[model samples]
Structure formats: C-alpha cells, structure tokens
Target: MVFMNYSTSTWILILGPLAVFLVITVWVIELLAKAPPWYPAIPIVIGFAVVFLALGVLIRAKLGKIVF
Candidate 1:
C-alpha cells in the first residue's frame, strides 16, 4: 500500500496529531454526555487546560526539547 512506503518519522507525524485529536474528541464527548447542567464551565475550563497542555507538548516536540 502507498501508506506502507512512508518512513518512521513520517508515520509518527501523521499519527501523533490524529491520536491526540481522537482522544480529545472522545474525552469531550464523554464529559458533555455526563456533565450536569450547572457545570458547563467545568468542561470549558478543562478544555482550555488540555489545549494549553497540548500546545506546550507540540511546542516542545517541534523544538526537539523532549527531556525524557
């Protein structure tokens, strides 16, 4: 298959964001499904936190600054 011809780094580049997106989508959906009506800000705040955390990770990864 054409996909099989990609290099290892190419595979990681393709799969990393995809995996992050899938996980975040599932997490948000599950939170909304079970969250109470009075707790709407909980998801928004947590979503922002997750977004910042992901952005930090993306920045570090882009800079090749991973410590571990």
Candidate 2:
C-alpha cells in the first residue's frame, strides 16, 4: 500500500472540503435568492473536481504509488 506525506494529505483533506463547502454554500444561497439561471454550477463543480483530482495525482506522483 502507498501513503501520502502528512503535509500534502493534510492540506488537501482540509482545504478540499472547506473549499467545496464554501462554494456550495454560496451557490445555494444564490440559488435560493433566484439568481440568474444562466449561472450554472456545472463549471464550478467541474473546477473543484479537477483541482482535487490534480491534488490526488500529485500525491500519487510524490509517493510513487496510489494512496489508500
């Protein structure tokens, strides 16, 4: 099995969910306020997905294997 370095995993684990929560919270507020329908969330979600995926890839690359 592989493991991520403590710092990398810690930051990713902390920041990833924090960021997602903030973004979604704001998005929901805007949604409830009936903001423009054209303000799609797909891009925001996709952006976060890419960011987290890249963080995962970075961890894997640094550890030289998949992390559990």
The best candidate in terms of lDDT: 1
- lDDT: worst 10-residue window of model 1: 59-68
Give the poorly placed runs of model 1, Cα more than 4 Å off: 36-68
Query: Which run of 10 residues does model 2 get worst, by summed lDDT?
Result: 59-68
Please give the distance, in angstroms, between residue 42's alpha carbon in candidate 2 and its true position after superposition: 22
The TM-score measured for candidate 1 stands at 0.48
Each candidate structure's TM-score, on Cα atoms with residue i matched to residue i, is 0.48, 0.39
In angstroms, the error of model 1 at 13 is 0.2
Give the per-residue lDDT of model 1 (tens digit) for 1-68: 64466678866765687578667766776777686773566666568767876785676556543331
